[model samples]
Target chain A: MSLTILGCHSATPRTSAHPTSQYLEINNKRFLIDCGEGTQVQLRKYKIKFSNINHIFISHLHGDHFFGLIGLISTFGLLNRKNDLHIYAPTGLKEIIQLQLKTSNSWPQFDIIYHELKNDQSELIFDDNKVEVYTVPLTHRVYTNGFLFKEKIGERKLNINAIKENPEIEICDYQNLKNGKDFVTKNGTIIENKELTFDPNKPLSYAFCSDTVYKPEIATIIKNVDLLYHESTFLKDRQEIAATTKHSTAEEAGKIAKKANSKQLILGHFSSRYTNLDLFKQEAETVFDNVVLAKEGKIITVDNKTFATELTINQ
Target chain B: MSLTILGCHSATPRTSAHPTSQYLEINNKRFLIDCGEGTQVQLRKYKIKFSNINHIFISHLHGDHFFGLIGLISTFGLLNRKNDLHIYAPTGLKEIIQLQLKTSNSWPQFDIIYHELKNDQSELIFDDNKVEVYTVPLTHRVYTNGFLFKEKIGERKLNINAIKENPEIEICDYQNLKNGKDFVTKNGTIIENKELTFDPNKPLSYAFCSDTVYKPEIATIIKNVDLLYHESTFLKDRQEIAATTKHSTAEEAGKIAKKANSKQLILGHFSSRYTNLDLFKQEAETVFDNVVLAKEGKIITVDNKTFATELTINQ
Candidate 1:
């Protein structure tokens, strides 16, 4: 799975700093999360294909989180996009979008299926053969949610050398071998599935939490995730402001990452007041050593076996 | 008067190309017109002070015209602005903005006064001591109105030398003399007003029109404008598409500019399909000689006598 940080700043989009938005690619599925203002432009700057993005997930209804939704939806219409767009956001998003479209009298030709989330508990929101997405309920100024993207366990791989040695293991028998079934020879000899097939690559998981307070209970739901993206809107020095605004400091985010036992922690949603991002990484490192600061255009790639081997940390 | 074109593209915002948005500084008044997506960032890019902009004029409800408004307003709240914001838009805009703010549950400290427009004729919308703004109604796919910004006639200046020649012109009579009144000597000798004071610098006017069809009647209302910004969404080769989409071609924009007797014409709202922006200027020049194609960072400053002397044309 690969994650592209389109924008990582909090509150406002400045000259080069963008608000919250991310593009994730997992199991051949593309997902856009938290579209802040100028997200469509960020997508263009990063060269992400607009048509390939079929699903959009919004963490909250804050302007910095989902204000760009209408513009993106409108652009898709002007491009003559044929695919149906699926939006997973808060309960009031649909009504607001519909009101804008009605006011303008320019509705998109494509279908927009909205999956409004009103549930207050962690639950499965999306499921397919390749992946599963679940909500991580968050505590914020308004109703909020964090998403957990988990890749499903894939089929076993065939051991080519082992299968080649057994002439009775025909091409048709390869399917059963991949399904982890034992191979039975025509002469009544049986071969173990482990000997005929290799184990599948380990599945990976990423947890995205933003615009939320320091909720320690979140660790239980996103435990052992390969990558965890947590909002660090402030540093260790502004703990009081962090609490008042329902935002977490870098130190708090690191504590949560450490408690969750995540393989890697990606800190983002920085307040524009801070110019030295390395301070966030340093503060996070005090609690958790495996921490990386998120920056616009930074890419983080994670695998179950290799872990976060390819990461563009913003120092 | 100075006009900054933040974005001038017709439809979707692309790389280095923005949608419709402009910043106008007339008589020390800051006004934002047509805030498309990424406009706030563009304003920041151009170093325009956001806090000084008290009035915002939205042409229409189309995404390309006003999608950036919410984000900018939200940013203003985040910055803790104390000045009230005045937005002049369609009737439904108030409801839509209110819905988003209500959903987010983060209301700004300052109040937003709405001057929703439903007029179909040239009626005054904003009247201050220094400037006046009127709606220039246009035919489009939806209810849209262009804005005409005019600098009101300023107080006449007193010729210091003429005042020195007449000791009877006391300091207390300066206000009357600045009001275009003649100086009367204590000996009952009346002096002509023109001889005492030179005429004030000619008042400047600008007419903004966009996302409209080829409507020649627009010239009657915007006659003799100092600067006219007309939409040139397409070239003459795509006149059929322009007509069908209710947009104007460069040639049409030139014709309108020529017929209106505008001193300068700024051709903008360009389609993204065109790479050579000079072709638009060329097409416009066939009917109007003083034509400039709009670029993202283009600044067109107009004066009464100097005309379009400080212009940064794309080509």
Candidate 2:
């Protein structure tokens, strides 16, 4: 699984800093998260294929989070998109989008499905054989949600050397071995399933938590996650301001990461007032050892084994 | 009067090209025209003071023409703008903007007055002591209107040398002299009004006509204008496509400029498919002698006396 940070600033979009938006690729599915204004331009600048985005997840209705959605949708129509598109967002987004299309008298050729979110509790939002997605309710001035993506466990791997030594094991029995089943010979001789096959790589998971104050309950729900992305709007010195604005400080993000026992922590959604971002890392490092700033155009990958985190620059 | 081109491209916005948006400063009033996506960034890049903008004119409800409006309004709120903002657009835009604000639960502290336009003929939309703005009805796929900004005829300039030569002209009558009233000497000698003062600047005018087709009727409405900006979405080779799309070609823009007897013509809103824009200028210069391309970040100034257009780059 891989995650790409498109924008990571709070409040306003500037030439140097953009609002919040990210791209996630997991289980052969591409998902766009929180399309801030100018997101379509960012997607083009980062060289991401516009057609690859099939689903969009909006955390809230703030202009900084979801303003670019309609423009992206309109561009898709101009580009003649034929596939269906799905939007998972808070309630009231449907009316905004529908009204825009109605006034312009231009509708997309593709089907648009809106999954309005209104619940305040964590619930499974999407599920397929390969992956599952759940919402992480957040505490904010507005109704907001974070998404958790988990990879489903796969079939067991075949032990090629062990099967080769046992000539009695026919090719037709390979399927059962992969399914963790024991092999039986014609004379009632049995071979243990563990001896015939090795265990598959452990399933990996990533939780995206942002735009919320210091809520320890979120940490409890996302315990022992592979990777965690949290909003660090300010440093420790501005904790009071963070509380008043319903935002989190860097120390708060670090506390959540440590409590969740995540292998890696990515801090993002910085406040525009703080130009000296080194203080954020210094404060977060006090509680969490492994922390990385979510810079725009940076990609983070989660490996299959042990959920190791890898960072790379885009282009 | 000065006009700045923030973005002047048709359809989708790109890294090199922007969508339709322009800034017009006429008679000391700042006006924003056609706020396409990324317009706020363009305004920032051009260093145009965002707070100085009091009026916004949207040509139509198309995404390219007005998608950046909500983001701009939201940013004004974040910046703590206290002045009233007036939006001149179609009737459907109020619902779209109001719904977005309602869903986010973020209403601006400043007053927002919306002037809904549904006129099909040329009508005066804004009139003050110093300037008058009229809508230029155009033919397009959507309901679109162009704007004509006219600097009102000012008080006649006081000829200090002539006033000094006339001993009978009293200091208390300076206002009357500036108002172009003839002076009668005590000896009953009548002095002509032209001898006392010169005419003010000839009332410079600028017409912004875009996102429309090649209609000859537009020339009659904007006759003898100082500067004219017309959409040149295609060249003569693609005139058929321009006709089908209700867009104007560079040659058509030149024809309109020639018919209106405009002193200068500026062509913009080029399609993204065309990278080399030399053909646009060549096609336009065929009918009109003075023509300029509306390059992004390029400032076009409409001078007073000669109605000459000057182009300069934004610092």
Candidate 3:
């Protein structure tokens, strides 16, 4: 799975800085997460195909997280898109979008299916043959959720060498062999499935945690994930403000990542007050070594076995 | 008065081009008109003082015209603005903003006074000693109104050269002279007010007409303004589409400017399909000689006498 950061700043969008938004491409599906204002422009700037965004996930109702949604829907109408778009967000988003459309007297040519999230516990929101998406309920100033995207185990690979050793193994038996079935040769010789095929790549997973306060229980739900993205809105020095605002500091995010035992941690949603982002990484590193700052336009690739080398922590 | 084009393109915002939004500074008051999706960034890019804007005028409920409003309002709350904000828009905007704020469970520290327009005729929406803003109702798919900003005639200027001629004029009489009152000297000689002072720079005015079809009646409401900005969403070739979309072609906008006898005409809201904007200028110039394309970030200065030399239209 590859994750692209479209925006990461907290609070509001500035001329050079953007708010929270990301694009994830995994299992042949394109997912847009937390569309802030100017998200369409950022998508265009990053050259992501607008039509390819089939699903949009909003973490909360904050303007910084979902203000750009209505415009994107309107733009889709203008583009005459016919594919159905699914929005998994808080219950109130549908009302907001419908009201805007009602006032404008324009409706989208495509159908918008709203999957309203209301529960405050981990629930499987989306599941397919290749992946499953679950919500990680988070503590915030308002109702919020972080999503965990986990790839499902695929069909076992075919062992061509083992198959070549069996003369009675026909092409029709290849399917059964790949499904973890042992082959019995014509002369009563047995071939083990493990010796035939290597294990498929370990099921890769990525968890997105943002706009939430420091909650250790979240780490338990997202433990041992290949990659973890957590919001670090402030440094340790501003922990009081962070606590009052229900936002996490860099050190807090780091502690969560370390407790979860995630392979890699991405720190994002930095407050606009700080110009240098390296401080976030440094603060996070005090608790967790594998921490990367989520910069706008940066792309991180997560594989099943390890984090991609291209996006390794700078340190 | 000075008008700054934040975003002028019609319909949806693109990567390099923005939608409809403008900043008008008149009589020491800053006004934001038609805030599109990326207007906040545009404001930051142009370095306009965010706190100076106390009034926002939204033409209609179209996404491209007013989607940026909530974000802007939320940003104001984030900045802890204390001044009350006045929003002049259609009746439904209040509910939309309130719903989003309610869902987020956050209210602005400042008060939002909404002046909901439900009329279909010209009406004075705002009035003060220095300036008066009137709504010019226009025909569109949705309820839309253009704005006419007229500077109130100021106190007569005290011509220093002419005042010096009267040696008996006391400092206390200066206020009376500036207020256009004749000063009676101690010898019972009447010092004519006209002789002592010249008229203050003739009251300047500007009119913003956008997102409307080719309607001639609007010209009557905004007649003879110093500067007029009209939406020209299409070229002459796409006049049929413009008519169907309730938008104006370049020639249609030019005709409106010509009929209104505006001192200067600015054509904006060009469709995104056409990248070469010179054709819009060419089509508009065919009917109106004083025509300038509304390029983003271009500031137009309007005085009582004529348009400023800095923004002189190329012949």
Candidate 4:
């Protein structure tokens, strides 16, 4: 799985800093998250293929989070996109997009299917053969949701040496071995399933949480997540402001990450107030030992056994 | 009158080229024209104060013309803008803006008065003591209108030497003299109005024409204008495509400028297919002697005496 942070700042987009937006590719399925203003230009800067994105997940209706959606949809029409596109967002977003299209008198050349989310509980929002996406309801001024993407477990791996020693195990019998079934000989001799097949790589999971207050309940739903992205809008010193705005401080995000027992945690959505961001790491490190900051054009890659990040300059 | 080209490209905004948007400071009135996506950042890039802009003019509902409007309004709310905002746009824009704001569950702190235009003929849309704005109806795929900004003719300039010679003329009568009234002395001596004062500089005028087909009617409306900005989406070689798309070629723009007898013509909205913009100037210079190319961050300053441009690098 690979994730690219297109923008990660809070509030308004600036000359250098942008708002919330990201590109996620998991299990070979690409998704766009929270298209803030200037997102299309960012996508172009990163050289991401626009046609690869089939689904978009919007966290909420905040201007900083979803203002660029209509422009992206409009560009799709200009580029003559013919594939079906799916959008997972709050219930009110449909009316907003439709009205804009109506006013412009231009609709997308392709079909747009909106999965307007309204539930207050964590619910499964998208499901495919290789991946499943669940909603993480968040606490904010208005209704909002984060998304959790999980790769489905695959069949067990075949033990090539073990199978080669057993001549009775024909090529046709390989399917049963991969299915973790025992091998039976003609004379009623049985071989254990574990001896014939090894376990496959564990499935990977990523949870995206943002624009929320210090809600510890999220830890339960996202427990043991491979990677966690939580909003750290402010540092510990500004906890009061974070609470007042229904945003989370770095310490609060750290507490959630620790409680969830995530393998890795990425801090993002920093407030525009303070130019000095080193304090965020110091504060979050007080509670959690592993923490990293999210910057625009940063790429995070994760697999069954390894997770790493690399920063690439776009400007 | 001064005009700043924030963006002036055709169709989708690319990594470098942006869409249609400009900042017009005419008669000391700051106005934003055609807010394409990423315009707020462009405004910041050019260091144009957001507070100075109270009025916005959208040419049409096309995304390239007005996609960045909602984001700008949202930023205004974030910045705690207390000044009232006036928007002049097509009839359907109000519904679009309102629906987006409604979905976000947030409204501006200041009042937003919308001037929804539905006129097909040239009509005055905005008039103040200092300036008057008229809409120039154009032919496009959708209903679009160009804007003509005219500075109101002010009081005639008082000839300081002539005024000082008449010691009997009181300060209170200075207003009358500036109003071009003939100076009358107590001894019944008469002085011609022209002798007492010089006529005020001809009211500086600018016509912004864009996203339209080659139409000569614009010449009649903006005759003898100081500056004219006409869409030159294509060169003369692509004249057929220009006609089919309802866009004007560089030569067509030059023809209109020549017919109007405009002091200077600025060509903009270049198609993305062309890499060498020098051809645009060459094509326009065929018919118009004085023509310049519009580039992002290019500032065109227009006064009664002269018209000048200075290119400022933003990237």
lDDT of each: 0.90, 0.91, 0.90, 0.89
Question: Cα deviation of B29 in candidate 1 (Å)?
Answer: 1.9
**Residue-level lDDT tens digits of model 3 in A1-315:** 889999999988997789999998777667999999999989988888998998999999999999999999999999999999999999999999999998899898899999999998899999888888999999999999999988888778988887787778899987887788988878887888888888877787889998999999998889998889999999989999999999999999999999999988999999987888899999999999899899888889876555563562211
TM of each candidate vs. truth: 0.97, 0.97, 0.97, 0.97
Model 4 ranges with Cα > 4 A deviation: A185-188, A307-315, B307-315
Highest DockQ model number: 3
lDDT of 2 by residue, A88-181 (tens): 9998999899999989988999999999999999999888888888999998999999989888887789999999989999889889998889
**Second chain only: TM-score per model?**
0.97, 0.96, 0.97, 0.96
Tens digit of lDDT per residue, candidate 4, span A124-209?
99999889999999999989998999988878889999988889889999898888899999888999989989897788888899
lDDT of 4 at B187: 89
Question: For residues B1-315, could you state the per-residue lDDT of candidate 3 as single tens digits?
Answer: 889899999888987789999999888778999999989989988888889899999999999899999999999999999999999999999999999999898899899999999999899999999999999898889999999999998889888887788888878888998888998888899978999999888888889998899999988888888899999999989978998999999999999999999988999998988989999899999999999889888988775555563552211
Model 4: lDDT equals: 0.89
Model 2 CA deviation exceeding 4 Å by range: A168-175, B168-172, B186-189
lDDT of 1 at A87: 97
Provide per-model DockQ scores: 0.85, 0.82, 0.89, 0.84
| Model 4 alpha-carbon miss at residue A232, Å | 1.4
> iRMS of every model, one decimal?
0.9, 0.7, 0.7, 1.0
Which pairs clash (backbone N, Cα, C closer than 3 Å) in model 2?
Answer: none
